[model samples]
Target: MGNALRFLYGGFFKPQSDEPDSLGPHGVTISTVGVSALAHDLSQFDITSQVPQGLSQHVVSSKKAQTKPPPKTPEDAAKLITQTLKNHEKADVEVHTGHLAFYGLPLPHTLVEVETSSTPAYQPQHWKFELHTLPVDAKAVADGDGITVYVDARHRTESANVPREVHESAIRRSKARAVKNYAEADALQKNIVDAGYRVINGPNNDDILVRKYRIRLRGIDAPESEMPFGKQAKEELVKLVQGKSLKVCIYDEDHYNRSVGDVYCNGTFVQEFMLKKGLAWHYVAHDQRPEFALWEKEARAARVGLWASSNPEKPWEWRKNRRNGV
Candidate 1:
């Protein structure tokens, strides 16, 4: 009986070569070749079994956990903003205090303290923050000293405050476009523009929503449209900024509710350009920057632009006369 058992074990469970053996049932040794053959045989069977209903559901839920819906509450919006900042940090993007203000978020304590501590150069004592605007359209130039700008809404805190009707209109516009309804989409876009917002093509050809702002160039006052050199001033400004982006450091809001800021384009100070070109006057009453007066003096000495008239009428004076029906 013992000899018969040994023979059976050697045939079925013993290692077939000098290779290591894999442990089988009851600590019995099985050769690799035998295991491979067994696996092949098992593969021939219906091994493509469906997962148990509960386990499959769990997997579907795990996938769902990877995504989240848009924020619907103030708390959720705040959390999303925090997450966005974190993501920006992770991507090595610079975050400025002014950027926070531009987003309509509260300034950080450190920034608030610094801002209140002392005045900085080229910035007014009441200076608020900077705004890096999107590209400006030719029609956005109201005059040499004023422009209508748009700020991207994707990262702005005020986006949370966007009217529900605007969002619904945008949604409808998108659906209309998807359905090839061009007229409906255009009409919806008109409504959005009337609400102080617009959808424009982004760098990647994607649609981007932006909010509007009227900006008044600080430090100088350009001639009125009807004044001498007025058309030239507007033309010069359009040539400088049409379809170009700008950096605006806001100081205050004017009576017209336009943001009064120092505008820079391609590293050129826009107010300086207008002053040096003799297209505008140094509005000393509003801004008493010595550089502005110096630029105006240089332009006057060169007898360029409005300075060619020797004693050209100022825009303010022109407006004053118009107001008095002179």
Candidate 2:
């Protein structure tokens, strides 16, 4: 064990020896003597000084006084400490705090407290967050907490999949159409089916409703499935909702799985976006016109996408004509 003492009242690390002791900031006399297998100089040292224990401290050198080394800047101290720790190949490290005099100078300095830990870097899992029809319009609502929900709906069948409730609900909704009851069950089946649910009637009267969403294609609204954009719409619908869990609210459903609900992807309303993007025209009979006023205005102003045609017929009108065998 090696021991070294410091005296900083005179602005340098003057070693304390057989001389009288001096007072420190705490009003205690700064003097120490220790002998052990693991004691170190508790004082900060000059970089020029070979670490104290490297030489013999037992010699009393009164003939020619040993002068202190140059003062160290905070940056120098930091670099020196880091390098010392890295290069200290021979000794087992032990540390202790020393008196302020160990600094050897009375300069008003700002000591920054730095903290370090050996923690692994964090990696966030990429997730999809979406919102459905809320009180606010799609344009009015912003992302990042506007009724957004996190769902792990995967494109492939995997262990880490969507919530069980989402899957089960989809299966149940899909299977409801297969049930033999057409009278009372029709409306219920339509409601779920229209809400982008795939109803499958299982054995033993069980039903599974799997959710399949849709995409709206650009241009030409064919009559439901026959109109130009009709198939494109269905295909787009599949892109938007199939294999993806969505928050949906239905006004009604066609005999097919075509739903009348507004769809949302990642907190953004797909239906409103489609309408605004001139992908789909507004459903006339279902005149919740207020909800789509902004989108209609946008489509009209752009004169792009589906609105390229001067006087396009509505899907309902086309469907009526088809039914009438015209």
Candidate 3:
């Protein structure tokens, strides 16, 4: 260890010999601690020699300090964001806040959103997406007790590998999207086949329903986010499940990979709750359930919830009109 310590000392290494074969040092020496000489000296001893007892474990300093990583390119940023999302359990990631700055791509993403699963909150907690790892050139700011990240987006091409969940996010993002708009990523394409269901703690103590993946309450259609009662409907859904856990009967996945199924709290059908309150409509075109349509009728006759409107439009019609610029 003493020899090793001496070998590591600055004065040990001399400049290399010009002869290359000569063990003797050569070259115009400045400091006696040149690296080439140390190598030559150390080679004479047993290469596997152990460190002496009580030798300091502190790292010897290098002449040059390490350089910081290059500023993250939009491509690099996108990849990092995707990998970050992919590595975690979907339920664990939380994107509360952030913003992305597009770099070289001519994407409509000038206003693109990255969405994931939502953990419905009633009291408005200050936590959004709490990414386990931080991205480059981005800083996390303390915002109202939560964090808001700002990223500089700079990429030349759309990385096909990134998941849609990270890039073209939908309005109802999962917990993966607890984000405020700082970066992007892509979701893995997983095919579903009656994997089964699960229940978890939502923002409150309620039993939030889940399958192997996110589920869209089947046999019914709620207002689109832009529809008149859309915001209210979402708030209402959040409230309904606020202090409740759910029992889900998952049927299948929509074309978008979301689960479409029935939800029951205690013994009460959640879809029925939504309809009775006029928060949703029976989606007759895709539904196979018999009782759902019956509930819609009752809500309609009562003139309660949305049915109170003299001529309330079904949710699907509202969506079609919006797509057609109605």
Candidate 4:
């Protein structure tokens, strides 16, 4: 009985050691005198009755320790939800439903319905999607039909593809600014700009990193810079879009790799505006929209802008002639 008590005590409370124990073969070291005192103290208790209850309590406590604690804060809750979602395969629809139910969150009627509810539907077949650019600068308007614009990188689809070095440089730049190291920050910013990105001030005066895109206005051809009324066309475009955001419905990429898109600013269709003003041609060879033809005809009838000329040379024809050395 004393040996059994010693064994139980050693199993439960013995300090770990590398050396073999003198009193027992279980690596538990106890002097004879110490064992005598331990047995005498335990003699008062009903050992059989107490040991089972104590062992059961220890087992119960161990099981409780293994259970996960509930999240303590909103951020923690969000993280928990994200982790749970990541654990299941995306195709495990039934499992996801069960998880939502377990968490007492309302399940969506359908995944596709939920996804499409917030996103804009694509325009019928022709255009791919829309790009809402950041505010344009005066210098970015290269010509009447070409402009350079920046899109917020954070919101772009390819933002995740940013190089690790660029990200590191941005971080370093931020730290440099915080420490008032303007020179270092400027150098880092130059590197970011060289990589086709810019850190511009946001509406809240915070820095926003943006990716640059060169856009060619679709369905319109404006005169070359040296052509008659070309300066007026550029000025008109600059007046319309400078310092304003634009909605560009992208159709295709031109040979120059510029995004060919229809530009709209402040509820005005920019191409339509230019065509109606006779600042640009309808570019009928590339686009056959009847409204463009109608707008150009109205401008010609009114004798406004370049339409005031008895005969205006087409910009595309001019370009072709120039290229052919005509």
Which candidate leads the pack in lDDT? 4
lDDT of 2 by residue, 25-128 (tens): 22223343221111233333343344444322322233221232221333333322332222332221111012122322221121111111111111113112
Which regions of candidate 4 are displaced past 4 Å? Answer: 1-123, 156-158, 180-183
Please say which candidate is ahead in lDDT: 1 or 2. Answer: 1
Residue pairs that clash (backbone atoms under 3 angstroms), model 1: none
Winner by TM-score between candidate 3 and candidate 2: 3
Query: C-alpha displacement of 201 in model 2, angstroms?
Result: 17
Candidate 1, overall lDDT?
Answer: 0.65
C-alpha RMSD values across all candidates: 32.3, 25.5, 29.4, 29.9
lDDT for residue 202 in candidate 4, whole number 0-100: 83
Off by over 4 Å in 2: 1-223, 251-260
Q: What digit string (tens of lDDT, one per residue) describes model 3 on residues 1-326?
A: 23322422222122334533211111112222324433433343236443222112211222221122221232332332232223333221121001011111111222122211221211113222111111211122111011121111111121343333433232222333345332321131121112222223444664332323344766678776666666667666665554444544445657876555555545555676777777788878986443455457658878877788888777778768878998
- The lDDT values for all models are 0.65, 0.37, 0.39, 0.66
For model 4, residues 1-326, the per-residue Cα lDDT tens digits are 33333433343223335533342211223344433443444453334423212211221123333253433333333333333323434433333343334323323232332221122222346888678888999999998899999988777564786777777788888889989999999999999988878788788978788878899998899998989989999999999999999988889999998999888888777887898788999889888664466567658878999999999998988988999999
Ranking by lDDT: 4, 1, 3, 2
Candidate 1 residue-wise lDDT, 190-276, digit = tens:
999999888888899877778778999988999988888899999999999998888778888989989998888877778888988
